[model samples]
Target: MSPGLKFIDFSIMPVLLGAGSCRRFLKTRMLRKMTIKHYSSNRRSNSPDNQYSTIAEIKEKMMKSFGLEPGYTTEPKSREELLKYQPKFEDLPARSMQDSFSSAIIPLSTDAVLQDKYINFRGFARLGRLLEDMDLFAAWCCHRHLKVPNLPEGVPLPYSIVTVLVDRIDFTSVSPNGTQDIRLSGHVSWVGSSSMEVVVWLEQVVNEEYQKITRALFLMAARNATNTAAAPVNPIQPANEEEKVILAGGADRKKQRQILSAQSVFKVEPNAEEQSLIYQLYKRTTPVEQTGQQRLLPPNCIWMHDSFQMSTIPSFPEHRNQNNTVFGGFLMRSALEISWATAFLYCKARPQLEHISDISFQKPVSVNSFIKMTAYVVYTKENYLQIMTVAEVLDAYTGSRVTTNAFHYTFSAPDPVTEVLPRSYHDTMWYINGRRKFKASRG
Candidate 1:
């Protein structure tokens, strides 16, 4: 599309999934460089004496090509006016769930609260993190209550909340007559739910130059006490790693619109062709609770243990530098794709169950390595089922393990199309298989 046509490309970041992390989206494609031929026929009217450049320069040019204004600008602020616009969201008092069931609402923070200078970021990225927080809270709640059992070797929980949007925002900052208190105030309205949307707003203020964030609202989705089917595996917090980029001026990752509504849950179905592909991976990786400790088939089946796609592959060549690993949701999305694909292969009666917060990444897959992955059936309840994923990073040449991790996925009932297909060869047989492919490095 031409720049004058649509501006949607100006926004939205395509998700890039690494082994265990989800990085933000770049403005343009991450493939081979994009080159544009800026042709001007009239030499006198158009400056014709331009220079030719490499594809790298073309990428930079593309950054400026689309008729878009630069997002960040630094108009020199007057020392007097620097105190304004310090905080984007103001703090408000929070209502408790006790108030909710009672049909009462309470605010969390107040006008006197303050804000600090925080890690600076634009809109989409900020909302993306808020969503991640939502996922963390949901997972914690699930883990505390629901626990899926008979786990095949190597699988763990990776349940998380996906960021959808910033429903509301309010900013409060001011410059008093002659005072010198640079302050910040605001609140973020967040919607949390799988199908039934539960919305909450958090009030926050800056302190001490914005180095820390103190919660003015502590909230979580209500647990389904009636459905005591399994123990919940998710906790109400983000992963325990704190990192910062040295030069962190990267574009935002993404703030996708919520596709699955708040009331929805994951469903699964089995098919033949999908069985063949995954049957090659998950035939014999069943859980073995030998000597009271749970393990994989072949007793300690590493083959079935390292088949999930939660890790990255290092480069085969010496010079290649692309290593894709970031946030956990990207990996979960990939696993869901594979889970559905694998379910079609072996399932006869039920689709598959996709339980959350049961995935664990135990190792880091470095740049340029081959990946080994596997999946297997653990157990079933009614039509809801659970499968295990074992993912590992490996040396392409020596076949040595580089990193290993595991996860458990849930699938639901079969669909109409799945009911029609005859059982594939993989439906009856089982074995844990793994493979890898070679491709050129990403530019």
Candidate 2:
């Protein structure tokens, strides 16, 4: 949580806490059991029917989307062969925007989509799964920026890149089910001493035209494998005014983050402008006796931790990235899925992500570690709801847990929410900050 610490290092910390040691601090058994039950039910709702025709149909749709021919090579790329071609930073070849470009076509699994009364019927691609694809592409864009040549055998280059933040993602459209292909592409927009801002966009073909589904800004940091410390990233060369502008935007975002970290709303008193806004909010308040409105937080109001919570299956090999840790994109998707459920429950309608203010990976979660995700409705305004999801790793042996990732999401629902009122000063600060985010997003 210290400013000096860009992220938490779990390797140096004590082992995760045991379940018994963490019990009191966790949700009640009945609630947790229900959470698991609800998760299972959702999975069942989306499970595949195991029909051969269904699988074949999805595969054919994907191939067309990817523009792949029947005779295309299907052999797996060999890692050993790729490693032989690994190039050092300086030895890396020069690349243009097209050279750095890459894309993937994957079949959308039925089980990955969530069905809810509040969601639109046109499509059901889970936001978490969609984000996972976006993260991978952004990482690939950074890899190309480093100009690491492809190995003859498909071996990955020896280097490490990790996602530090998903600063923002604006969802512009939804990819429908009939439009099966999820297209992702990105390029390095800016570079710092050791950080690169990779901008990625998600798209799909609709009515014979490409529809942009989402555009995201991902902040990634390069590292040395030997020491696992920050390492310099390859600088980007802007070719046109558009690129130059994008590069500047990335730099500005970094500066904004620095300024925000230093003077977060929770850490300091409001300035004149912010104080004026707060005063306006207070002045607009009406007396409950006259307005016949609810006063204070209702006793039955939902607390963030009390509902829609679930722990992830232990991190596994299949989910590991080049760093041999759980993929950052996977974590992002996981958090989003749980937060979506939380928002849906509160709204009793469909909720869509409008903004992901930030996703800070405080610690790298190693493979096999257990993760518990908790979502809280920290603030709400009109039809927009601000949810914060915190991820922590539990040390089964030591019964210790350390917070690893914090994700802030803003969702817009069809209906206005029954506002969540803060009962304490700490809660009030968070509420005010949430409102600040809402206002900033509008601008």
lDDT of 2 at 30: 21
Give lDDT per model, in order.
0.28, 0.62
Off by over 4 Å in 2: 1-96, 107-123, 148-156, 272-295, 298-313
lDDT of 1 by residue, 1-443 (tens): 12322234523433333311221111112100111222333334331112223222332332232111323223311222212211111121222211121001111122122111111122111222322333333222222222223333333221222222122111123111111211111111121232112222222223312211211121223222211111122111211111112011110111222222221122232345545645533344334333533323443222322322233333333211111223333334444445655555545443433233224445444434465555554433344444555566666677677435554454556642211111233332222111100000000
Best by lDDT: 2
Candidate 2 per-residue C-alpha lDDT over 1-443 given as tens digits, one digit per residue, 9 for 90 to 100: 11222243424533333322222111122223333454556655431222112323433433342223343223422234223343555654444343444444444433244234112345556677778867777776676676444434333344567898887677775644532655555667678767777777666566654466877888888775421566655556655344445556667788899998878876789778867755544434434444555334354354433434566558776676655578897898889888988889888897888888778888889877988898878777788888878899989899899999988888999977867655444655666777777766666
Please report the candidate that would top TM-score against the real structure: 2
Q: How well does candidate 2 match the true structure in TM-score terms?
A: 0.69
Query: Residue 180's C-alpha lDDT in candidate 2?
Result: 62
Q: Residue 133's C-alpha lDDT in candidate 2?
A: 67
